[model samples]
Target: MCEKCETGVEILTRNGEGRRNFLRGGAAVAAAPLAAAGFSGSRAAAQPSDALAQSEVQAWAARDTDGTFAPYTITRREARPKDVVIDIMYSSICHSDIHTYKGDWGMPNFPLVPGHEMVGRVVGVGSEVTKFREGDIAGVGTMVDSCGECVNCLADREQNCLNGTTFTYDSPDQVSGGVTYGGYSKRIVVTEDFVLRIPPGVDLAGFAPLLCAGITTFSPINHWDLKPGQRYGVIGMGGLGHLAVKLGAAKGAEVVVFTTSQDKLEDARSFGASEAYLWSDEEGLRSQMASFDLMLSTVPVAYPMQQFLNMLKLDKTLVNVGALFPVEGAHGMMMGFGRQSLAGSMTGGIAETQRVIDFAAHHGVAATYEMITPDQIGEACERVVNRQARYRYVIDMTAA
Candidate 1:
């Protein structure tokens, strides 16, 4: 049985022998679609009889702080009663992955497998799993698990769990007693609640980035309740910035792009910006001071925060989603003069993550990406750091 939670997310439930019976009956119903889709169960299935048994899967991992990836094998814990095992098809490289791999964020757990944005087909489910079935197109994002008893989790804010949330990779795993591995592998086993369903008729590869970049931008927009015809300013036209322009415009806001790259001005407009200007254009920037209803900065590097904050109208907000470092060059006067607010956001909670994915599908928004094989991850990381990638890079894990 299923019922809607306060966030309007359907919560699936079953108990005791009823759950086992449902799994036995649902297997055929699930397998029929997989067979029709040419899914061969030879390699994907993980129906281990013992709960303590583990499955060895092939993956690429960064052995050290150098961030170079090489072939490795990792073990996935057997499916628990509420688990779903996925055969990964594509995994997108997130900037956070690069940061973690390079130790830019801190000393990561060595031999880390860094990935979060992934889309795959369900291959197996635990005996009590009810929300997903074999062959469902599903995704896993930044988080895999959170302490469900926390007030934040109960409120559908698992990303902000007062108890530590288990990240997709390199976080202390509460369930397995080791660090969590991520989707840079051939397969992964995740709890059904953390797995997301991909909407039909969407580009699977293109949709992968929606798990991270899409939600990162949408959460802030959703939080601020950006209204139609409001002037929305986006800083930086990289991965997050490009998506912000697309999403902001889709929300009926008058989108504007403020980028450091002259080349991105036209590209920004193409992504749905009504106006595009170089951030270095002092006169051009000053002309629009206090004119924006909301502004979002997606630039990872430190820049003049006061400049972007100056663009907001009184009582308006400027949200930061990209920078992980200290924000400099802003003072109390910038905020006090207009009652303006500067805030930061991480990826959304599970329900909000699903909403963003569905929202993008309904509105035809997706990341523009370049495809590469797992072997190219090293080079791709370099490209990402150099800002050479057009927007995003998605790995074809099947090539491994």
Candidate 2:
């Protein structure tokens, strides 16, 4: 058995009865009618208290472009009728968090508490919330809310909502007025629809990266409809790249990895990749041209795109889940010859995020991560920026 599965077995042994009861309770609540739950379809009538009570909580924040984190305190709004209050246990550091803090993406709002991948236990639930209850294992990902009535949201693609999707942090907070504080803090209040239910027995720290790195890669795989025995390619072997390998292999694809680091080639193979190659392996890469049915690039920085696009089969696609910047070196001729396409994917929506979580649990796939205390967040972010993190860095919120 994999190490993740063995750890899960230990957790299950410890929490077996509680997990069963939690599952049963969740199902019963889901089946209950809105009327029985004291909820109504009207938005105005269902609104929570206008007073918006707030409480101060401890956290870490980046005060400037230096990206140095220091002790801070932020206020959290009390749970509304449709919200869930989670006491955060683990928060995973994502590369984007560093980008935002360092102003690489843009100048974020000052005093930014940067974290989106979080897993914790529910401590409070709004009166009308039916999806979760106190003591349930839950998670919050890259997004917190969206306009539910938009065309995209109606179709279950909340990430592309017509009005605008509210990100977990550094986005406008419709309720609290300034901005939404993220999971680097001790507690967070999120709407019930945005909260994800986590499988009971998995390692919470290992499972935290699934909120961002896992979903970012899985969304494209799902959209492309990757099938059994298909050739799959992943570029870069960082946090996102490794998860792509595990997820793709779990779906029965013959997964291959391409990376600049010689060390990660072997690591990729251990992560279920059928083959791994360095980008410098011109002969090996050229041999695989026009052979891949689908490819995903998880490199956060700019890299040559033409080589990967050339490897896609006719009518196939190379999806970019990272590199928010404009892609260069991808000429029209490279794509026109093969009738191939280049696409981009954001993080998954609510339902899709939940699906990835459940899928990871069932497949025994978990991130290889190093644990750190909240005080070490700055050093951890530095390591991530320097490409030193082996896979992921997860914050142990309970530690000093």
Can you give the TM-score per candidate against the true fold?
Answer: 0.89, 0.88
- What TM-score number comes out for model 2? 0.88
Model 1: lowest-lDDT 10 consecutive positions = 1-10
Each model's C-alpha lDDT? 0.81, 0.82
- Please report the candidate that would top lDDT against the real structure: 2
lDDT of 2 by residue, 65-146 (tens): 8887998899898778888777788899999999898889889998999999998766677888877766567889999999
Error of 2 at 395 (Å): 0.3
TM-score of model 1 (CA atoms): 0.89
Would you list the clashing residue pairs of candidate 2? none
Clashing pairs in 1: none
Model 2, residue 256: C-alpha shift (Å): 0.4
Q: What does candidate 1's lDDT look like per residue over 1-400, in tens digits?
A: 1122212322222232322233234542453354325534324444445322478889999988777899889999878888988889889998899889878878988788989999887777888777677767788999999888878877678899898999999999888888999989988889877887777667888889999999999888888877778899998888888899998887778999988788888898899999999877889999889999889989877776987898899999999899888988877976899898999999988777876776787778999899999989888988988888789999988677
